[model samples]
Target chain A: MPPAASPVPCKPLFFDLALNHIGFPSLDHKLPVKGAEAASPASAGEANKPDQPGGLSGLVKGLWGWGSKK
Target chain B: MAHNIKNVRIQAAYAELKKLIDQGSYSRIIKTTNKIVNDDQSQPEAWQCKVVAYIQLDQFKEAINAINKAPNRQQMQFELAYSQYRLNKVAAAIDTLDSAPDKDSPRGKELRAQILYRLEQHSECYTVYRELLRTTADDMDMERTTNMAAVQVHRVELGQCPVPS
Candidate 1:
């Protein structure tokens, strides 16, 4: 039987390289909780008052919020 | 905290894949995204990235496989149609969109418009493009304009439109 070709090495996924995409800068950082800021109209004085949802749910919720009126 | 890290990791991985795609490093993208898929096959974005990488590599069969791995097949229909289109399976691409229940979906309609244009169905293609321009996002402006112009030229050549009397 013929020998198979050597498998190519997997390049390490890098953050800076990944951040080259236009959308990634926001994705790399904290995403504000949807509607949290709007729900508290009086919190204009506070610098960071959001009760943010973190991680996948937050991202999904953010995208869902963009897609639908809520 | 755990969920936050997880999402960030996934997003970073996805972003890396997108970057590699933009760099035209399809093989590297496939290798890396396959690792992500192996860790968690449920990530739709990962599967989508893989599908696009495979398409860029002209690996249509693998692109189809990657899309099939996605949880929501309906959501990935546009990508599937695109892979089929690249494979010169235009009718199959049209059928893929047609079979989806959301006939009015912007993605389906836009892709169908492109396919219709490819099939030289200029009138129907133009109507689809116009509807898309009215209904879709601003990002679609370039595509809609290009398709509409192509339709106009095709119509003029066929004597379907008056050349301004």
Candidate 2:
């Protein structure tokens, strides 16, 4: 017999802003098609890191128009 | 009759708005629909079109307000939930979708499952997708497979299921 199904959690999981209507995660970055070769590696590396802002300072930075640093 | 003429005019305006939307003219969609609504607020289709334009322009608050005032709120509940979901109003989105008139609508179910996944309600989300597999037989294999994987991961995370040996 198949394994018993797991129970539903009382609360929901963390949210993902990049998910589309179909339950698939959308690629947040623009694809490198036309100007990919011209792109710098530094920016590409930054794209891979998660978007967690650490604390109050990070939240302030986010609110005050500070972007991700190199 | 004057009413028939007004209906024809509204249809023409809506057709023009639809063309603008297809051309990706979201701003013009708003402008044109604004005129249409000013003339006829009873046209629910115009309200719906304006809501769609606002969403495309990333104006979630405006979209939410528009949906709230829509005459056919039940018909447009999915769009309302979608805007709420985009705004990170997860619980509200779920609630809105729960009240959708078409309870078994595949699109509504699919979006609800996605929101459930975001909330980490993986087991419940997976169950929804599984039910959808039977109701929706087209272009859903990837959705099902990914949701299954998500549920398995969630189960392991919760220690309800062991990791593969």
Candidate 3:
């Protein structure tokens, strides 16, 4: 099977918080790459999340502190 | 909207504590710090959240409910005994340890002795600490094992009386 074409190129952004010390534990514990991967859309059905309050949007918003889009 | 009390800011601490404890990170001990602050966060799961928060901060209470919520047997017994000790209740701590399902586990024995020491039951602590030293069993954490053994010696020696000059 042919692979799907990329819609957009990805890039990583880095922030330098030179003065922060607690950032170490905060980053290590909170940025959950594990849960994010498990919750990928391609593998999970859409309907499954409806029962979960605001659903996936709520989860993502909660995980990364992403506020509701304007 | 009656968004109620399920705000992310409210639960963020709990979510953090759960992850930290699961990974054995940093031992965020908080069981006995702010009793009044906790008695005031009126919300669902408030007590559980308070107990967990306090456990992370090392401000442990009697931990009756906290013990029930412990994710595993060892942690549950440890918290239960520790809470009892904080309340100046030693017999209850011993009872809790005696009833633990895995009494033979070194951590379990360590916990029981720690409780005795907290109760100022130094002789018992000395005896149990000696017993733990003899186990010499293998586990993934050799460093932690050695440290716990050393803690027993440190406590016993510290508890000893000074001779009159």
**Over the full model, what C-alpha lDDT does candidate 3 score relative to the true structure?**
0.50
TM-score of 3: 0.39
The lDDT, on a scale of 0 to 1, for candidate 2 is 0.70
User: Local distance difference test, per candidate?
Assistant: 0.66, 0.70, 0.50
- C-alpha RMSD of each candidate structure in angstroms: 16.8, 16.7, 20.1
Which digits, one per residue and each the tens of the lDDT, describe model 1 over residues B1-165? Answer: 977676666656766766676677878877867776776778665666666667666788888987786785666676677778767798998888777665566666766777887788989988988887888666547746765876777777789886655
Candidate 1 chain B lDDT trough over 10 residues, lowest sum: B138-147
Best by lDDT: 2
- Candidate 2 C-alpha lDDT tens digits along B1-165: 987777667666766776676687988988877877777888776777788778778898998888788776677777788888888899988998898775467777777877887687877887887887777766646656666666677778888678978
Higher-TM-score candidate among 1 and 2?
A: 2
Query: Which scores higher on lDDT, 1 or 3?
Result: 1
Question: Which candidate, 1 or 2, would have the higher lDDT against the true structure?
Answer: 2
What are the per-residue Cα lDDT tens digits for candidate 3 across B1-165?
A: 334343434345545555655664533423211231243344323344345445545555634665464444353554565566556677887887688675656666666665665565656666765676676444423543444444444444565644224
Per-residue lDDT tens digits for candidate 1, residues A1-70, read: 9899898634222111101111111222322333365467566534353465458887887789888975
